[model samples]
Target: MFSYTGGVVLFAAVLHASWNAMLHGNRDRFLSMTWMSIAIGVVSACVVLYLPLPPKAAWPYIVASGLVHIVYNVSLVRSYRRGDLAQAYPIARGSSPMLVTLGAAIFAHEAIGPLHALGIALISGGIMALALQGGRVSRAGALAALTTGVTIAIYTVIDGIGVRLSDGEALTYTAWMFMFYWLMPVIFVAKRGAPALWSPLTETPMAVGSSLAGGLVSIAAYGIVIWAMQAGAMGAVSALRETSVVFAALIGRVFLQEPVSAKRWLACVVVAAGAVCLGL
Candidate 1:
């Protein structure tokens, strides 16, 4: 069994995968991404009002994280545009734990035990396998996913540091970060023009509705992750949280009808094994 924090993060991983897999249902990946961002931002804004502000020490990180998250979302939309959810999502997400581990070590000064190292190595190899899946996901998708992974690593460390420095205001910090980070539909509105962005709302109300649900799930998932980070090493929390890749592989295969090769299944197993090692 996982430790308390590990269990919490594991639950978060499930939620994370659920929402991401749902993301494939939309016709426009950009629209889905934008709508989900808006939905999460709206919810976060409401919650952030009641929550106390994070300490000044955490504000810089909050701002920096917000900037980075924008990049992450944009890259994610691009990756999905060019790839299968299983291939792109795993490559995007599975690569993050190792990056976070390295970032946490250098920036947070966290020590890596042998088990942790082994776990990261396994996860990294699994990600490589997923990325190498032939002709299923485009080169552009892989590149975009790699970019997303980098942003994920950067923000994971930033948020880990931010939330831990919140003086027990982890909830407040997380809420504020999400609220500030997204401001949701604003960027898309600017890009597509307000008319273009909102007009789709009427046509694809289902996508909008599902995206809203996903937004709620996304916030809840990351909220748990930020809370868990307070009690675990940033690297460990990140590694464990990334077990979403396994769930993602399944969701992509079953619901979305994305092909999952035996090789991909083996890779998912390897990733899960790595996650277990990280938990241990």
Candidate 2:
């Protein structure tokens, strides 16, 4: 079950990195994010209207997931601004699966065997290696990225339970979850006032297209991962999907002109190997 789901999640990871690279390629990060959020909002709203409401019990998790997603968006945008996509992307994504593993062990009583622990350690080390550039590591950037990872893990676990509680309405839960997730960007734009927000929109079509792509990818990646968790282990599903870090590294090297040292490549290999182990 996990092997099949992991394959789909791997494709999701590729899409995930592709859209992020698209966002990073844009000049106006804020505008790109705004457009992406709007696209996500529109799609999610359409899906929500067509689907049934989630069960009452799923509401709390869905709401909490939305709030966490807001934090993730804010942190991700900030992190991207602070450093190279190669640096930020790996750190932010690589840290989450381990946290999810820990959370599952403690909260859900999911047991982690010795091999899984080693796999988690390798993934963490690889992420760290990728984040460090020229022997200079940004502790703040790492923390911010880790915070994003933690929040993702929180929602992963929440949604894992949510899908089960939704009486098998995974689609309904996901649609509404994204609908609520879009609210944070709207609130952020409102808080920033109109001028600061609208300036980015007028800038370029590349920016708009990038944001739309990002929004669509976000919807697809997460929706598939959530569904995978419904059909497999939450921890394994999160870990396997995050192998997108490897893809992110490749995108960074080729497109962003970020340095990918031999050591970092080795780390990427280790992370990929760990993911394969977890899938097995």
Candidate 3:
């Protein structure tokens, strides 16, 4: 329905899935994610210099969203460690819209319509299919993926509300949040020191470049999302962005050489369908 914003967010979805594939494929997930965050923060620092600060109303939500994002990263790394990208990626992304739906109904006392129910059903079915795959998804991985979904839902709500409160300064809010989130990673790098952080820079220059590229892609992906949320309904925008689940499954199969079964592919499609339903 939202053609212009839809095209932008679908592009974001592809970029999101691509970077996530890189994260899942990396041997040192935590370090790679941290490096990506550092790169994003560095770039954001420069970007934010020219843009005016987001209005005061958005600051608290920005900080809260940043903190929750840290939790999302930690859970995501753990999920990848414990499961296949095909399994973990779908589970993580698929559950987000459902949770966002449920949270609104429960916490915000919003009534669930037929479309929301249908979307939840589809997402739950997809997740169930993923979980039912014998020896594919670990218990810890499922839990971690669910945790990641929770964080996504929380931050989606926060950002949706926060950006609207920014008085049309969505880019400003996004830059500030990206910069603020890396504060933890900065401390992590400090404690680990230069040798640890710079080791990949010298040993594997390509990995360094990949992480940097992923960071830029990540910034662009989420920046679009933040901006799109300002123009669209929060739930729909979040759901549309989560179409990444399908792209991730394909990337996991092709790029990572992971053995993706037909059923798994179907499940991913179902999850994406659910997300689309939520958007519609």
Candidate 4:
């Protein structure tokens, strides 16, 4: 189970980075995100229908996860609109493992070794260094991204607990959580305006294609991580999956034409090394 979970975590890290890159490629972040949400909803709903229901105890966490994910998506979209993905994605994702580690300590009474603490510090420092590049970090954008990180940590812990409570139906819970997660965007559209809702439908084919890719990769990334947690320690799974930062930095440099100084590249290496330490 540990070996299988490790493989899943590695695969999830790649897919997670791919979807983030797709999101970064879009010009209209909100519209692209809406389409991605719809795609995820459809896929998750199909999975939910085919799989058995999760145990009753898992529903509370599932619902809480849905609410937390809504905040994460909103903050992530806003952060991307305000900052470059290289800056935002690393800070956003990098903060999560540490937050999850702290949450585990408080809620689950889980203790971390000195090595894990060192890894967390390295990861956090690397992200901060990356975010501080260009001599001007948008505080609002950074805060929004950091908030997204916190929400992700919340949901990660919640879902981790949910999977444990589930009677061998982690996949089913994951599918349903995603199915209900669509409600956030749906409610946002309904409250904001119909124009915001309908605009994505008229987007160009290329934009729609990118959105679809983002949606598919997002599902694959998260689905694999959730499955992995069922078979391994949640902290290790979370830490390993966050290796997405390395890919995100590379994508930003290559595709977004963002300036990647030698300093940032070194920071990225530090983050990757930290993730390896956490995994070990």
Taking all chains together, the TM-score of candidate 3 against the true structure is 0.90
Worst 10 residues of 4 by lDDT: 1-10
Q: How many backbone clashes does candidate 1 have?
A: 0
Worst lDDT run of 10 residues, candidate 3, spans: 104-113
- Estimate every model's Cα lDDT from 0 to 1: 0.82, 0.78, 0.79, 0.80
Question: lDDT tens string, model 3, 1-280?
Answer: 2478878888999999999987777788877888888888899999999999889889999999888887887788888888878788777877787677666555444455688567666866785575456675667888998888889899888887788889999889999988865765765577687677878888887877788788889989999999997866556666677777677767877899977678877887786677677657
By TM-score, the better pick of 2 and 3 is 2
Q: What lDDT tens digits, residue by residue, belong to model 2 across residues 1-280? A: 2466768988988988888887777776666777788888899989888888899998998988878887777777777886788877877877787778778778677777777676667777677677775655577777777777777788888888777788888889888888876675676668687666666656665667678878898899888887877767677777777778889889988998978888888889888877767755
Off by over 4 Å in 4: 1-4
Candidate 4 per-residue C-alpha lDDT over 110-217 given as tens digits, one digit per residue, 9 for 90 to 100:
777887777677877787788777766687988888888888899998888788788878778888888865775676678677777666567587787788778988
lDDT ranking, high to low: 1, 4, 3, 2
Could you tally the backbone clashes for each prediction? Answer: 0, 0, 0, 0
Scored against the true structure, residue 181 in model 2 reaches a CA lDDT of 63
lDDT of 2 at 205: 57
* Weakest lDDT window of 10 consecutive positions for candidate 1: 179-188
Top candidate on lDDT is: 1
Give the best candidate by TM-score.
1
